[model samples]
Target: MSTTLSPLIDLQLKGFKVYEKNLTLQEAERPLLAAQIFSRRDYYKVLLLESKCVLHYAHQRLELDGGQYLFFTNPHIPYSLELRTDRLHAYACLFTEEFVAAARSESLHQSPLFRIGSTPLFKLPASQADYVRGIFHKMLAEQQGDYPFKGDLIRTYVQLLIHEALHLQPADPVVQPNNAATRLTSLFLELLERLFPIELPTQQLTLKTPQDFADRLAVHVNHLNKAVKQVTGKPTSAHIAGRILDEAKALLQHTDWSVASIATCLGFEYPTYFNNFFKKHTGVTPLSLRRKD
Candidate 1:
């Protein structure tokens, strides 16, 4: 079943928050940890968990039992957690890509923990678990403190957690059926959705074709086409065109960017190409769409 896990918003800052699993719940309230089935969120997450549970992450599954586990998830991938027993204890840190951009680390999305197709779960040794727990404790304290530089301190802790996970070997996922098509389709969609909202005029879409996505996902174009068609009932090119069309309409209606700027941002070599594509898909020019709004 599909579910949406809402973020615990931080009023002081829009993008980052930390949670102690038990403290957030009332005496009569149960944790909603299991409500994350196949859900995607618009932030990055690092979780330190002490529970017996099953994690359905993208196309992979991991069964964790009474061990200290560290999990990393990004906005693009979909994941879920199923508790095997009710005794749950965990600490989670959630932040957006913008929140940690100020850190002196490499791009968080390119990190092994958050990269697509990389393993996200790790089983930590008892001693390492204690060290990881200490970082989370510091994050919790800094999040509530009145220090003006607390955001910077929290970002440093987030980097520490990521660096720690980088040194650990990721846990192996449980073996499953040969559902390559489903797995590839899920990954394709995730990659497609990752380049969205077009927050700035200078921001550009990178993977705009089936071959581009295929190369990024490390699959042949034919295989990607077959898999996307088999799973989504549409060709890979159709999906790409559909998403571009949607973004074109949204940009035209919502922003004051010139048609040429929008065209370049969407990866068109020329505004004429964008014009033809938009009219072909929507039967109206980009300017016409804007005028209607």
Candidate 2:
């Protein structure tokens, strides 16, 4: 994230930045969370970054070999990483949901990038790295010109990267689509889908509580739990907690915010409480996860 101001986003949102003007900056962010970024309070961001070091997020450490690829999450998530070696290579960029805002179309969905449903992070094989690099390299090169559509061009490059990365992933496992065991589980997911700004695996927030989601759905908490479990083979709280953690992972990897800020966002009034809760569930403290990154 860069401290200097830019015209890329509206000023009303409190955001953060970090950037690289030269080579040594890379060494500065050892055990770095994210390279540099700006996040608006109004909307979340989708970031792209490069790294040669291993990263931890979603309870896993991504091997950062040149052929491997991972995602830079928004604040609605949690993520972390630690350098496996002092020498690593990476580049990243941030764009909000509004940044990629476009009308729905086959091209929008069929595009390799936007087609991803839930798991936003993807790993690319050696065969596809060059293809992915070519698109980002072009995006990086575009800054050299005074093109009137530089922003648009960069956005296009990002979209292409998503599509290409998706194209190269292994075939997904068979999970039946919308085949819940009961009507309530379906309703729960429906309500969840409508709840925008969910805890991204890259974020932290209080929306994790069952009551918060229940109030939105206007259903009794126990009823909501039973309904979701009967239909999905998992408790409703499990689903909620899972969503929170997934988003937590995303935020940890993609943003530079401290654990306290992240805890507050995820709904804990106190950061320490949030820390204990997360550690209890994930077996790792938030800062521990961040330090790993």
Candidate 3:
């Protein structure tokens, strides 16, 4: 039987004060609020907002200014932002594995761009940021406008996001070669890319164990932990559990799945155990989050 995994990037914040705020920014000086998601999955979805906000990432943060960019990948690799401006205009678009296939020939699957073992997320510097911004803005305009070939154009812009990101670097730090520890962490990250959607936290159906994950990858548990920690600076269990809770929140907010059923799907042997686990992770009962319509 197929297990149900959690959904990545659950953005429907329940009952937050921000929900009642304005969503458009026509003002000339409105700041930008953006967050780029870097994930373990194959999809990349960037959120471009017109207000100011913090950029959410796996381990770090970016303070967004006017008309900023936020990139995302699947399995919700840690990214989000809290907008500061009064009005927020944002467009979120998703590109799947199709992007890679469309970008390169079959033989180049192993190329550096598509390599599962390297960094998958990159942010544009201020110098080149405007170019990328224009591409994405054109995309948003195309999406909002009624153009005959709007769909095709949107895909083209999405392609540009990836292409441009690969070339853009941070302001103060330049990317360097991967060291032994970095290599190990990169391998674990690659493993997450492969394992995430297949063992989706939302699906609730999965082995749900670090040992099981290590076994599936044919690596020792300690070795895997070392590698994952070295690269990401977070423990393997932290990623796994966080991914699970993310989907749990998504489903709890979006679906009518019974808590017991959701729990079982997430690999808890008993509903009570799942309940406790949920409480421990979220500090609130599952029903509280699910109570909203």
- Per lDDT, the best of the predicted structures is 1
- Judged by whole-model lDDT over C-alpha atoms, candidate 3 comes out at 0.55
Which stretches of candidate 3 lie above 4 Å from their native place?
A: 1-43, 49-52, 58-67, 75-78, 83-89, 95-133, 144-147, 169-184, 198-205, 226-233
The sequence of per-residue lDDT tens digits that candidate 3 reaches over residues 1-293 is: 22332365232221110111235434422222221232224444555444576665544556767554545444335344566666665555555555335444542234333344433444445656567667755765654454555555565676666557555544423345368666555555555544334233356444476786788767798987887786777888887777677656655654567888777667778889988989998788899766732
Could you tell me how far off, in angstroms, the CA of residue 18 lies in candidate 2 after the best superposition? Answer: 11
- Which ranking of candidates, highest lDDT first? 1, 3, 2
Tell me how far the alpha carbon of residue 284 in candidate 3 is from the true structure, in angstroms, after superposition: 1.2
Q: What TM-scores do the predictions have?
A: 0.55, 0.53, 0.63
Candidate 2 wrongly placed segments (more than 4 Å): 1-37, 40-66, 70-75, 82-88, 97-117, 169-178, 182-235, 238-293
lDDT for residue 54 in candidate 3, whole number 0-100: 64
lDDT (C-alpha, whole model) for all candidates: 0.77, 0.55, 0.55
Q: Report the Cα lDDT for residue 280, model 1.
A: 94
Which residue pairs does candidate 1 place in steric collision?
A: none
